[model samples]
Target: MPAADWWRSAVIYQVYPRSFLDSNGDGVGDLPGITAKLDYIASLGVDIVWISPFFTSPMKDFGYDVADYCDVDPLFGTLADFDALVARAHALGLKIMIDQVLSHSADNHPWFVESRASRDNPKSDWYVWAAQQADGTPPNNWLSVFGGSAWQWDARRGQYYLHNFLTSQPDLNFHQPAVQQAHLDNLRFWLERGVDGFRLDACNFHFHDRELRNNPPAALRDSTMVSSVNPYGMQAHIHDKTQPENVAFLRRIRVLLDEYQAIAIGEIGADDSLAVMGEYTTGGDKLHMAYSFNLLTSEFSAAHIRTQVEQFEARVADGWASWSVGNHDSVRVMTRWGGATPSPELAKVVLAMQLALKGTPCLYQGDELALTEADLPFEALQDPYGITFWPEFKGRDGCRTPMPWQGASAHAGFSSATPWLPVPPEHAARAVDQQAAADSPLSFARNILAWRRGVAQLGQGDIVFFDAPEPVLAFRRDLAGAPSLLAAFNLGGAALQFDWPQAAGATPLDGHGLPGAAEGAGVSLPAYGGWFALV
Candidate 1:
C-alpha cells in the first residue's frame, strides 16, 4: 500500500486519555503520561494511536462537550504537553489522531454564551434555537440521548435551544456557513499542529432539518438495534439528525484534510447505520471511513457477524470501513460477549476474528489484557447519563476506569494518589504485569498482532464469508497478487467440527499462538478456538 493510503488497513489503538496513565499524581491521566508510554503502545504493533477527546471542556460529558476548540484543557495539560506527546508518538512510528466533537459545544463556550445573550446578538443563530408553541412546549418532540426532551429553554433569549446530549451541550447550527467555516478553521488549527487525523464524534448529528420537523416514531424497539435504557432510539430520527446537508459539510472537511494528507473516520449513530455509512464514505470525497454501533452491540454469533459484514459490503461501493468491537462508550467486549467471567480462550478468538476481517481494526486500551467492565455502585458512578438512569443502566464508567498496569501496586499503578474511579480487583488480577507471562491472553494478542502485520491478505483483502454451521464462522480473504487466507472460528463454548472441502492442499499457518485449534483434511476446534491457513 502507498504511504498516503496508510489508514486503509491500519491498526489504530484508542487511548482514552483519562484512564490510560497518570503521570502528574493528580489521580487522572494526562498528555505527558501518554508520552511516557509510547514504547509500550508501539509494542502492540498498531499503526496509529487514536486518542479520545482531551480538548477544553467542563467535564459534563467528559471531554465530549467542548468549551474551547483551539486549546487543551488544563485538567488534561497544556498545549505544549500535547505537542510533546505528538512528537514522542511520531518518533516511535505511531501516527496520532485526536477526537473532534463537531456536532455540539458546551453551553459555557464563548460562542454559545454570546448567542444566548439575546435573540438579536451577532451569534444568535450560531446554535439551534427555536420559539415555543402556543402551549409553551418545545418546538418539536426531539429527544436527547442522555434522556428527556432535547430542547432546553433559555430565558436570556426567550427561546429553547437543542441539545441531543446533556443540556450543557447545545447542538450547533450547521445551516450557517459561518459556523461551518469556524469549525473548518479549528480543524486547520490541529492540522497545523502536525496531527495526522481525527476521529469524528457524532458525525451524523452535525446537521438537523431546517424546518424543525419532529422525528417519526420507530416501528419497533430492540436492545440490539438501539439502547434499551434511553428513549432516543424510539424515534425514526428523520428530521433531528443525519440530514442531507451533512454531506456538503463533510466535503469541505475532506478538502481541508487533503491539504495536510490527513484522514478522518466518522461515528454514525442513526436508525439505518449501514446505509448512512455507505453514503458518508462513498465517492472518496467525504469521510475516509465510518463505523457504526452495529458490531458494538451484545449480539455475538457467527450468523450475526456474517450478516453485519455482508450487509455493509453489499451497500458500500468504493467506500471504506473501520471496525471495532469495543470502545470507550460501549461495554468491554470481554464481559459483554465473554459472559460474566473472563475467558482467555474467548479473548484470543475475538482478537483473531476482528483482525482477520477486512478493514482497519481499532483496539481499545486494556482489551489486550482481557479487561472486563467494573461493577460500580450508584454512588460511585461519575457519568451524568448513568446518574440520570441508574439501577437499570450503570452508564459508561464501567469501561472508563483507569488502566491497570501493576497488579501489586496501589490503584493498580494507575496513580499513587486516589484515582477518580476505583480499580476492580478482577481487573487487577489481569494486569499487564500478570498477563506478560507466556501463554496469557496478553501474550496471545501480541503474537496475533505481530503475525497480522506480516499478512497483507488479513488486513488489506476483500472478505467473503463461507457457508458454515451455527457455531463456526469461516471467511476467505483475497488480496491482489497475494496468497488468499482462510480464517475460521468457533464462537460457541462447546467443541465443534466443521467440514471444509476447500481446505484441500491448504498449508496451515502456525505461530499465531491461538489455543485449542487443529486442522487436517477438514478441521477440529475446541471450545472458543480458531484456525488460519493459506489457501
Candidate 2:
C-alpha cells in the first residue's frame, strides 16, 4: 500500500506521441501538442498517460531506438516542452509514464559509438560485441527482429555487435555493471523531472546468454511463433533474449524506481509472455505490472480471453497483469476481431471485458472510438521491419496513423500541417467530435473508467467465471466483503440469453450505448453487447 501502488486501479492511456496532435506546423506531434490535449485525455477518465518513446533518436525504429536516454528528440520538442507536459498532466491528476528502451540504444547513440570505436577502449564493453566467425559471417545464427542477422559488423573495432531488433538498435551489454548503472541514471533523470513511471520496452531482452552461445534449434520454429506478420519470433529466442539474468535487471530497475517512489510496467513481448510475465514480475520488488500481445492479437473468442486471463492468474500469482486489445504494433482490434468493417458494438464489448477483468486496462491511442487499421500504401510506410517484408507484412504504420480529432479539419485536426502518416479518410466519421455528439463510444469509455473509481472488485478481485451459454461470457469478480460483480458479454451476431448468477442485487447501466444489456438477473446481450453489474 504505497502511493505508487495507485497504478493498480489506474487507467493508462497510451499516447503514440507522433500521431497524437501537432501544435507546430511540422505535421508531426510534439510535447506542446500533448499538453494542449490534456483536457481531452483527462476527460476520458484515464489516471495515467503512458507516452511511447519521445526520447532523442534517429527514428529508424520510430522512437523505440534511443539515441540519448535522458534527452527529448528535437522533432518531438525540447526538454522544457516535456517538463511543461508533465506539469500539465500532473495538474489534471494524470500521472505521466514515459517509455524507456533500456534493452538497446540507437546505433548512432553516443554510447554505441564509443563502445564500438575500439576493442579495448573504456567504452568498448558498453555494448555486446564478439569476434566474427571463420568465414566472416556473424558469430552466431541469431537473427534480428527486423530480419537478417542479429550481429552487425562494426568496422570500427573489427568486431560484430548485437541487435535483437533493427540493426540500427544495438543491444546493450547489461553484463557490464557500468552499463546497468548508466541506464539507471537515465531513469533518474526522468524521475527528477517529476515523471511518474516508465513503460519499459522489450523488458525481457535486458540480458543475453553470457556465453554468446548459439541458440538451440527451436521446436515448431515456424510462423506460429512470430507476432502476426513480423518475422521476429521464428527462432526460439532462448539465447538471443529472455535470459534468466533479466530478472535481476528487472529487480535492479524496480529498486531504482522504488527509490523515487515510482513504478515500472514492462512490455514482455515473447511467445511465452505468460511465463515471462510470471518471471519478470515475480514479487512486489519487480515490475508493478506487465502487458503482452496475448490479448492484442486478432483472437477474440470468449473462451480464448477466459483461458488467457485464467492462465496468467494461475501462473503469475504474485504479479499484476495489464491488458490491451490494440496497440501501435498490431492491427486495431475492431478490424482484427470484428468482421469486415469496424464494429463499434464489438469494440465496446471488448473494452468492457478488458475493464471487467482483474487488471489494469491500458487503452491504445485510438481504440476507444473504434478505430480500425488504416490502409497505408507501401509508398507511405515508414516502419523498416514492415518494408523489409512488404506486401504480406504491412508493418505497424496502419495502427500508428494520426488520431482524428475533427471530422472535417485538415489532417483530421491532428495537425495544422500535413502529418507524418496520413490520417485515414474513413476515420473522420468516428472522430471525437462525431462520437462526442451524445453519450456514445467515447462517452462509454469515460463512463467505464469513472465507474471503475467506485469498484475495487473490478480491478483486483479474485475472478470466477460462471458456466454461461456460448457467446455469453459471464464471470464473477469477488473481493471478499465487497459486492461481487457479474459480467456478461454477447460475442455472437444474435442476442445471447444468460441466467445471471444469484448475487445480492444487480443494477443495469446500458444507457451508455455500448454492447450488452441487463434486465434484472436474466439479461439478453444484443449481438456483441455486454453488461457490467454492481451486485
* TM values, all candidates: 0.98, 0.95
User: What lDDT would each prediction earn against the true structure?
Assistant: 0.89, 0.83
Q: In model 1, which runs have C-alpha deviations exceeding 4 angstroms?
A: 222-226, 516-521
Worst 10 residues of 1 by lDDT: 514-523
Estimate, for each residue in 222-266, the C-alpha lDDT of model 1 and write its tens digit.
354346978887888899989999999999999999999999999
lDDT of 2 by residue, 1-535 (tens): 3455688878889999999999888989988989999999999988889999998999999999988888899999999999999999999999999999999999899988888778888988999999898999889888887778888887779989999888888999999999989988899999999999999988888889888888766565444234545545556778888988777878888888988889888888776888888777767888999998888767677888888888898887678888878788888888888867756777777788888887888999888888888888989999897898888878889999999999899888998888899998988778898896455678788887777777777766888877777777888888877777777888777876777645335865444445555655678778877777767
Q: Model 1 Cα displacement at 347 (Å)?
A: 1.0
Candidate 2, residue 257: how far the Cα is off, in Å: 1.3
User: Candidate 2: TM-score?
Assistant: 0.95
